[model samples]
Target: MSRSEWQKSTFSGASNECVEVRVVDGTVELRESDAGDIVVRTTPPKFAKFLQGIKAGEFDHLTT
Candidate 1:
């Protein structure tokens, strides 16, 4: 099946350390630009929940 174009947040701006995301065959896929061979896959609902948690600051501690 064809996959959607990979996308990364504009905030990443020239940074290869950022994560890129795309969807294929009803699954959401995420990968680190610096490590293109590795990928993480999850369902759309689960990915949405993860995004919600990130927006809610659940991962703030990990960034610091």
Candidate 2:
């Protein structure tokens, strides 16, 4: 992927540890700043559902 294609989280704010995302051909790619070699790919619909679950606090227990 090109450098221009990747996007970082707005909440990163100069932090070395942050999440980045890239969309290519209807697929979403996610990676962490601390682990650039590792990537997670998913479909747009699945990603949207995951985001909705996040907004609904479905993953809150993971952090706690």
Candidate 3:
């Protein structure tokens, strides 16, 4: 519901590289704190799905 003020995700606490997110005009916006100029926008449903994928380890290869 809040818009425009980016907040670092709790998953990124105390890290130099963090994920920042905000909502704007009903869409979710996400960016890396270290690269604020670039942003990725998606619907809330899609973002939720993305988070689920992360939790399910669907993206583990990228980090591993």
Candidate 4:
């Protein structure tokens, strides 16, 4: 597989500590900018569900 270009969120605003995402082989790839060596891959449907969960604040406990 070819290397994917990771993209940071537009809201990152010059911060090196942020999540990065890329699409590779039809899978959504995610990694932290501060720890690029590690990655998490998920299918499009699962990724969509994750995004929905985020919007629903399902993971809000992590921040508070």
Which number leads on lDDT? Answer: 1
lDDT for predicted candidate 4 compared with the true structure: 0.94
Better of 1 and 4 by lDDT: 1
List where candidate 3 sits over 4 angstroms from the true fold.
none
Instruction: Compose the digit string of candidate 3's lDDT tens values, residues 1-64.
Output: 4578888867788885988889998999999888989999999999999999999999999985
Off by over 4 Å in 2: 1-4
What are the clash counts of all predictions, listed in order? 0, 0, 0, 0
**Which residue runs of candidate 1 sit more than 4 Å off their true CA positions?**
none
Please give the TM-score that candidate 4 achieves against the real structure.
Answer: 0.91
Q: For candidate 3, give the lDDT.
A: 0.90
Residue pairs with backbone overlap in model 3: none
lDDT of 4 by residue, 1-64 (tens): 8667999989999999999999988999999999999999999999999999999999999996
**Residue 49 lDDT in candidate 4:** 99
TM-score of each: 0.93, 0.86, 0.84, 0.91
lDDT for 31 in candidate 4 is: 96
Give the candidate number with the greatest TM-score.
Answer: 1
Clashes of 2: 0
Model 4 deviation from the true structure expressed as Cα RMSD, one decimal place: 1.1
